[model samples]
Target: MTLLRPQIDPQIFSALTPRDDFRAIARWVEPRSSVLDLGCGDGSLLALLGNELEVRGFGIEIDEKGVLACVQKGVNVIQQDLERGLRLFEDQSFDYAILSQTLQTIHRTTAILSETVRVARECIISFPNFGYWRHRLAVMQGYMPVSESLPYQWHNTPNVRVLTIHDFDAHAHAAGIQIIDRVILHKGRVIDWGQNWRGSLAVYRVKRYR
Candidate 1:
């Protein structure tokens, strides 16, 4: 069964300019394909994909405000805890699944990632790199790192799992997930050198190894 693409206003489209990482994620998604967004906050990414790529998109958000915002943007959204898994969707239900910047916050990281790959032929995952030079420097000084990508304080932070590019690479290898492509970013610009130590954010397109 196919889903209808939401009809968003042109003004809204102009207002909701896709972030740099969101643009990167959009580049990986095929036009007119189906997408499932995990932990979609405010549905901006879904909206952008729907409008620009003409993709049929659905979003899962746990926050009430986020759900409301999605509704306002004419986005299809479900409000549910991500830890419960993506059982609602059948195997390969979407062409792409996105978990942007929410991987570290999820407790059942492995399970969620597995479910994501199960429900989608491909998945896009992005997270803040804990091994960035600044983050390491902060840790060496005996304080938790706080920057634009990781803006939350240690007490109020939602990031439970700290991971770097190397860590994710190892985990993906062990989990039998093939990394099709990867982009490392620092301040929205793609970093080409010393990604593990210099990049502040990591984006990957992956699929379950057959």
Candidate 2:
């Protein structure tokens, strides 16, 4: 039996059961390009992008373990706090900058997203939908939603600012960022247009407008 290393794309080791944590990310990114992953946890997605997509990627993570994981994968990674902002990087330094699932954890999406557009020509953002029917139902039932996508209890949840799919679109407009494309995923399936609000989660591609 081979021991699984965190450096490798989790897929390289069969013993590890792969989950959808990185699914929306891979689907939104191009196969061959430069990418920067903000809030890169454990460097799993960067490894997948490099190995499977053949993309040169950089990962910025605050975790020591995650930084080490990227290094072991032969990926360029930086240890930095996103909330402090990206002053070191120049404008449009990368083809794409990804902020997956991390949107809710940051203090300010407005400023963070501005940095994303400034640092990269394009950006990919995916987040949990706070306005999901189930979430609403939980309020009615007097209990927070505990579904698979959002599995944690209210008190222990890591999410700070859960924005709905519609809320994101509005922010994009306010930021003057153009949506390159957007898609919603529900139960591991892609939903067509006009139904994203009703869907569970969503990923979007955005570009800074002139």
Evaluate all candidate structures by whole-model CA lDDT and list the values in order.
0.88, 0.77
Q: Over the stretch 58-146, how does candidate 1's per-residue lDDT look in tens digits? A: 99988889887787787888889999988889999999999999999999888888888889999999999999999999999999999
TM per prediction: 0.94, 0.86
Q: Which ten residues in a row have the lowest lDDT in candidate 1?
A: 1-10
- Model 2 / residue 109 / CA error / Å: 1.3
What is the Cα-based lDDT of residue 103 in candidate 1?
97
Best by lDDT: 1
